[model samples]
Each structure stands twice: as C-alpha cells, then as structure tokens.
Target: MSNAAVLWRRVVAEAVGTGLLVTVVVGSGIAASSLSPGDVGLQLLENSFATALGLGVLILMLGPVSGAHFNPVVSAVDWWLGRRTGAGLTSRELTAYVPAQIVGAIAGAVLANLMYAKAAVSWSTTDRSTGHLWLGEIVATAGLIVLIFALGWSGRAAVAPAAVGAYIGAAYWFTSSTSFANPAVSIGRAFSDTFAGIAPGSLVGFVVAQLFGAVVGVGLLAILYPDAGRAADEIVTPHTDTTTTGATT
Candidate 1:
C-alpha cells in the first residue's frame, strides 16, 4: 500500500474505535439507568464495568491499526512525547488522529441514543461545572497520562489493556467528575442526554482542566521517569502493543 493509503487506514481505525468506545460507554449507562431505576451506585457500577471490559477489548482489537487512541488527549500526548522519536506518530498522524477520535466519539453517542430509542442528538442537562469538579478533571486526566507514559518507560506496554482499563474504572469512582478524562469522549457525551451525559455548557471548563492535567502529567513523567518523554526502541505510548499490527490501548 502507498503511504497515503496506510495513513488513511490508520485514521479509519481510529474513528471506528472511538465511535465504538462511546457506544459502549453511553449505551451501558443508558441501560444501567433503566435497569437499576433509582440506585445511583448500582448504575455507576454497571457503567464502569462495561466500560472497562469494552475499552480493553477495543484497544486489543484496534491498537495495531491506529494505536487505538480513542482519546484525543492520549493522541496529543503521544505525539508530543514521540515527535522526535521514530517510536511516536508524525505531525500528520497527530492531526489526523485527534479529529478522527472526536468525530467518532460523537457518532458513537448518536448511535447509543438511537439504540436506546431516544432522540439522535439531545444535549445533556447534567451541569458539571464547579471548582471541585474541575479539580477532579485535572486529577483524573493527569493520572491517566502519567500511568500511560509510565507504562512505556517501564517496558510494560503489553499490560496496557488491563492497566489502562482498570485505571479508568477506578478513576470513575475516585474522581468527582466520573473521570471524563478523554476530551473527545467528553465532547461526545455532551450530545447525549442519558445517564452518561455531560452538559454542553460545561465542556469548556472540563476540556481546559483536561489540558492542564496533560501538562501536569508530562511534568510528573519528567520527574519520575525523565527519559520517558521521548520514544525509544520500545513502544512509546500505551496505544501500541505486542502485536505486529501496531495496536494501541
């Protein structure tokens, strides 16, 4: 295949993976809400479990294709850290990946709502704007970045499916904002009005917090694993895996 063709394939994989991820996240939440009725904790448990399993599977399936970076923040961090190292994505890939992830995430939410027989594009009313919530976002996103990059440095790339999945599951409970660490996913959730949704009005602050968290994550990487910022012969990001197909988490 030509280089352009390869790039397009990767881009397509990213879009599909992200879309499916949102489908799993939003769909499960909607179902959980209905099944559990008024039990908030149960609903959250159902949603978190489904997300953990589904995300891990998606990463395993698509990582070899586009590094399965369903999250834009992950893609950005990967590109930033790996720009100089051949282990990371090129600028063109970074540009392509982030947009694909966002588009896919939105599509996924639409699909989830439709599957639940709801409106295709209703905005969420769940207002999550608050100082403490923003702080939670920053904490969640920063921890995510730190863990992912740290895996690369530790030469534990193969465990990313379990590690990343588990961390997200834990973050959902420990963090106040339910850990909307993925910017693309959060934007997509804004278009949903179901249990997993976030208010559109709150997107700006959440995204800002996430970005700041990414910076903090990078700083931590420098301190704990100074050499992890650049890619090495090993996989540079959590998105890449042991498969020859180039699967990412």
Candidate 2:
C-alpha cells in the first residue's frame, strides 16, 4: 500500500473510533438518566462504567490503525513530543487526525440524540463554567497526558487500553468537570442537551484549559522521562504502518 492510502485508513480509523466513543458516552448518559430518574449518583455510575468499558474496547480495536487518538490534545501532544525525533505523528497526520476526530465526535452526539428521540442538534444547556470546573479540566487533562506518555516510556503500551479507561473512570468521579479532557469530546457533547452535555458557552474555557494542561503534562513528562519522545510512536498503543511489515513501537 502507498503512504497516502495508509494515512487515509488511519484517518478513517480515528474518526470511526472517536465517533463510537462519543456514542458510548452520550448514549449511556441518556440511558442512565432515564433509568435512574432523579438519582444523580446512580446515573453517573452507569455512565462512567459504560464509558470506561467502551473506551477501552475502542482503543484495543483501533489503536493499531491510528493510535486511537480520539482526542485532539492527544494528537497535538504526540506531535509536539516527537517533532525533533520523528517518532510520533507527522505534521500532515496531525492536521488530518484532529479534524476527523472533531467531526466524528459531533456526528456521534447527533446520533446519540436521534437514538433517544431528541432533536439532532439541540445545543446543550448544561452550563459548566465555574473556576473549579476549569481547574478540574486542567487536572483531568494533564493527568491523562501523563498517564499515556508514562505508559509508552515504561514500555507498557500494551496495557494502555485498560489503564487509560480506568483513569478516565476515576477522573469522572474525582474531577468536578466530569473529566471532559478531550477537546473533540467537549465539542461533541455541546451538541446534546442530555445528561452528558456541556453548554456551548463553556466550550471555550474547557478547551483552553485542556490545551494548557497538555503543555503542563508535557513539561512534567520532560522532567520525569527525558526520553519520552522516543516512545511517541507507541502512544495509546503501538501503531503499525500498513505499508510496512511490523508495528512502529
């Protein structure tokens, strides 16, 4: 296969993987709200559990194709960390991956809404614009970046699916923002007015905080693992180049 074909396949994998992830998140949130009624705790439990499981499965399924980077921040961090070493996504790959992830996320939210008999594009009214929530986003995103890179540096990329899923599940409970660490996920959630939604007005702050957190995470990685960039190709999981014979870890 040609390099362009490989890139195209990877882009499609990222989009489809991200779309399914959002579907799991939004769909489960809708289901939880309906099943639990006024009990917010139970609703959250259901939502978090389903999201964790679905995310892990998606990563395991698509990591080999696109590194399963359903989050733009993740993609950006990968590029930044590996720019000098040429170990992570190229500039072109980053450009393609980010847009695909965002578009897929929006489509997933719309699909979730239609599945539950809601309007396809109802803007979320759930306002999450508090200082503490912004802090929560920063902390959540930073931790996620750290965890992903740590795994790669430690040669434990094989366990990323479960570890990443578990971290997000725990962050959902610990963070005030329910851990919308992914910019794509944040944007996608704004399209729904369901239990998992975030208001459109809150998007700017959340995304900004997430980007800042990525920077912080990278700084921390430099301190903890000076050679973390060497493992960039294995982030999220080991990515196999279709034109080549083996994984690029």
Candidate 3:
C-alpha cells in the first residue's frame, strides 16, 4: 500500500477508536445515571466499569491500525518524545491524528446523546472549573502518560490495554475530576449535557491542565526511564503496519 493510504487508514482508526471511546464514556454515564438515579456512587461505579472495559476492547481492536491513541495528548507526547530519534509519529501524522481524534470524539458524544434521546450538542452544564479540579486533571493526565510510556519502555506493551483501562477506571475514583485526562475526550464531553459531560466554559482549564500534565509526564519519564524514547513507537501497543516507516506510533 502507498504511504498515503496507510496514513489515511491510521487516521480513520484514530477517529473511530476515539469516537467509540467517547461513546462508551457518555453512553455509560447516561445509563448509569438513569439506572442508579439518586445513588451517585453507584452511578460512578457503573460508568467507570463500562468505560474501562470498553477502552480496553477498543485498544485491542485498533492498536495495530493506529496505535489506538484516541487522545491528542498521547499523540503529541509520542511526537515530542520521538522527535529526535524518529521513533514515534512524524509531524504529518501528528497533525492528521489530532484533528481526527477530536472530531471523532465530538461525534461520539453526539451519538451517545442521540442514542439516549437527548438533544444533540446540548452543551454540558456540569461546570468543572476550579483549582482543585485542575489539579486533579494534571495529576490524572500525568499519571496516564507515565503509565503508558513506562509500559512501552519496559516492553510491557502487551498489557497496555488492561493496564491503561485499569488505571483510568481507578483514576475515576482517585481524582477529583473523574480523570477527563484526554483533551479530545474533554472537548467531546462538552457537547453532551449528561452525566459524563463537562461544561464548555470549563474546557480551557481542563485542556490546559492536560497539556501541562503531559509536559510533566514527559519530564518524569526522562528522569525515571532515560531510555524511554527508544520504545516510543510501541506506545499504547506495537502496530503491525510499517507503511508509515519510522512514524508508526
């Protein structure tokens, strides 16, 4: 296959993978709220479990096609870590992947809303803006990056699907923000005024915190695993397609 075709396939994988991820998040949240009505704790448990299972399955399904990033921060971190050694995504792939992920995420949220008979693009009223919440986002995102890169560096990529899913599920309880660690997910959640949504007004802070968290995660990786960059291409999981050459991730 041509390089262009391969890139196109990867972009589609990222989009579809991310979209489904958001669907799992928003849809499960809606269902959880409906099922557990007044029991906030039970609702969260349902949402988290469903998200964890869905995410792991999605990663397993799409990892070979696109690394299953599903998050812009993950893609960007891949680019940054591999820029010097050319182990991860190229600039072109990064540009293509990020937008596709974002658009896919938004579409996923809308799909979730429609599925539940809610208005599409309801614009979340759940405002999550606050210093502590931003801190939670930073901590959640940083930990995610560290966990993902650590697995890659340690040649444990095979378990990334389970490990990542478990981490996010746990973070849902541990973090104050319920770990909306992905900027694309954060944006996508804004389109739904449901249990999983974040108000549009709070997006900037969450996104900024996530970006900052990525930077922190990278720094920590540098210190803890100085050779982490060597495994950049294998992040999330290794891909079989070599059509993109050195920019597989």
Each candidate's TM vs. the true structure?
Answer: 0.93, 0.98, 0.97
Can you write out model 3's per-residue Cα lDDT over 11-88, one digit (the tens) per residue? 999999999999999999999999999999999999999999999999999999888899999999999998888699
Q: Of the pair 1 and 3, which is ahead by TM-score?
A: 3
Using TM-score as the measure, what is the rank order of every candidate, best first? 2, 3, 1
Tens digits of lDDT, candidate 1, 203-240 = 99999999999899988987998877564323322443
Question: Which model, 1 or 2, shows the larger lDDT?
Answer: 2
Q: Rate the local accuracy (lDDT) of all candidates.
A: 0.84, 0.93, 0.93
Lowest summed-lDDT stretch of 10 residues in model 2? 240-249
Model 1, backbone clash pairs (residues 3+ apart or across chains), number: 9
Candidate whose TM-score is highest: 2
Clashing pairs in 2: none
Using alpha carbons, what is the TM-score of model 1? 0.93
Task: Please identify which of the two predictions, 1 or 3, would achieve the higher lDDT against the true structure.
Answer: 3
